[model samples]
Target: MTTELDLGSIRHAPKVLLHDHLDGGLRPDTVLELAERAGYRELPADEPVALADWFRTAAHSGSLERYLQPFAHTVAVMQTAEALHRVAYECVRDLAADAVVYAEVRFAPELHLAAGLTLPQVVEAVLAGFAAGQQDAAAAGTPIVVRTLVTAMRHAARSLDIAELAIDYRDRGVCGFDIAGAEAGHPPTRHLDAFEHIREYNGHSTIHAGEAFGLPSIHEALAFCGADRLGHGVRIVDDITEAADGGQRLGRLAALVRDNRVPLELCPSSNVQTGAVPSFAEHPFDLLARLRFRVTVNTDNRLMSDTSMSREMLRLVETFGYGWADLQRFTINAMKSAFYPFDQRLALIDDVIKPRYAVLIGG
Candidate 1:
């Protein structure tokens, strides 16, 4: 093991998470309180520790319903505008605590329909929550910037409607659009109209591809429907070949990913829990990193996977023998792939991430 990984001062690290799910990251305390207030009795237990363990076990079951159980509890409580706002606020606070300087959290506004809030209302409330959360973090001296990505569920047939909602709110706070949920049969091409509309209206898109599926799913997401970034694209390693000695050839698809700089939001622990990767030791992260795959690390769902940005980084450091420089590359890759205009993205690189790493390296 390359034993130079020290994350003791983790809050000082510049972190970026792009694939976190809003519904999948509810605080256990929030869930218990929300369930009590909402008079919903579906919690596995009222205690936070037990509740968190229940979420991890249930979500890690490798079954569709088990994986989606937490959403029901989270969505049921998110009926009122206030609940939505509180959840959004806490999400940002949690990210800030994890030292995430920039994060793009995505959620399907359509799922928040139980409270009778319109799509735009849901978007607005979440943005208000993010602003509130950032303000609170600033007051606490841990400033962080968070943006929302409006996601449309693939199982639902309202991609076009969601696309319009995202476009309408783009200037407000919706940074990009995504399609997620049960990627087995639902390919990104299913939402071509949504993608095309997003493309026409000057919107950005990142598809949940190559997670529960394989290269064909990724190919379809990128080739058929132009996914600018990929969520959980760990399977692209399938297309790469290891030759005699140290030579390698990225099958056409992996080459496309590398050449185009399509970022892979690789959630190491979550990938193992979800069975996307066999194990952390065998995870393709270091391989992808060494090969320059525009790879970025993330906590796909903090509540479900029981992970923080620090924990994810620590797991990779201890497993992959990653040092500060390796992690610095991951952060830089995420900044490059963030859904922002060139100038703002450059500012994140020049101001936030680079300066922090320089201070760490004494460069």
Candidate 2:
């Protein structure tokens, strides 16, 4: 079991990230460098600091337009094999610095075809980048491990192709399949064929459902497609009903989630910005957590959200007045839900996370 945190010594904490997006986490400096290299100048700001502020402001619009602008720039730079590898490598380097023990990052290789790179080439470049990033992070004494999730654009019709690519690279570092993009009209069932392939092949998957949409989308992702984990699952609250007293009413769907222990990758700030939760106090984070849902906090789109794991944790601490115990509970939830091998996951818990936390809480 994990213990309370001292906050003074958070560097040794074994953090885990499950809902990060590769195209959404570029460093401002790197964004500029890649933008210049790609000969694309859609950025509103020429400097790194201004560029970051610009991204934060755009993302704050809480509209699809704000969410889609930065990606246009990121995807533009990532068209080439070299640029893709470089961005992937730098992402891991940044995560390691943040003391991330394990991270599962996803990107859609199908979108990089504008520069004429094959799907396999895109996957290969990202793998090489992860390998290099791990080595570089280790040398810097901030060791981290990263796994890949190959995503298919939901509005587009490349799910089958991307699913095949993900399976091809599974042993090479790719962990699973995912469907991303605007979820309002393009439901997860639209890519059921690809989901069926992964299901038939025994490949694990987590879908981006119930984020921009509601419980109907999440229902299809799990019931119709058999999602291993839900990306946000924030809207599952639609099925929950609180009573006048301290007791609560568990709707059938909410009961299924609780009984099965599906992980809700809850990013409080991002969810609010995305209109999933409306506001922090009204957010279902405390509600879901108190109901014993397998809830974990995350930074879904760090660049757009202008967030990190530490920042998210600090926000929860501020909002709910959470102590070390709550933070550990959230961290354990993340560890249990990570897409890593069981033995390595246990080893991390026993060796790294448990020890540092024990020292913090004086166990």
Per-residue C-alpha lDDT of model 2 across residues 75-137, encoded as one tens digit per residue = 888999899899999999988988888899999999898989999999999999999999999
Q: What shift in Å separates residue 276 of candidate 2 from its native position after superposition?
A: 1.6
Window of ten residues with lowest summed lDDT in model 2: 1-10
TM-score of model 1 vs. true structure: 0.96
lDDT of the structure predicted as candidate 2: 0.85
lDDT of each: 0.86, 0.85
lDDT per residue as tens, model 1, 66-151: 57666777788887788889999999999998889889999989998875788888888899999999999989988887888889
- Evaluate residue 233 in candidate 1 and report its C-alpha lDDT on the 0 to 100 scale: 91
Q: Residue pairs in steric clash, candidate 2?
A: none
Residue ranges of candidate 2 with Cα displaced over 4 Å: 1-8
The parts of candidate 1 lying over 4 Å away from their true place are 1-4, 63-65
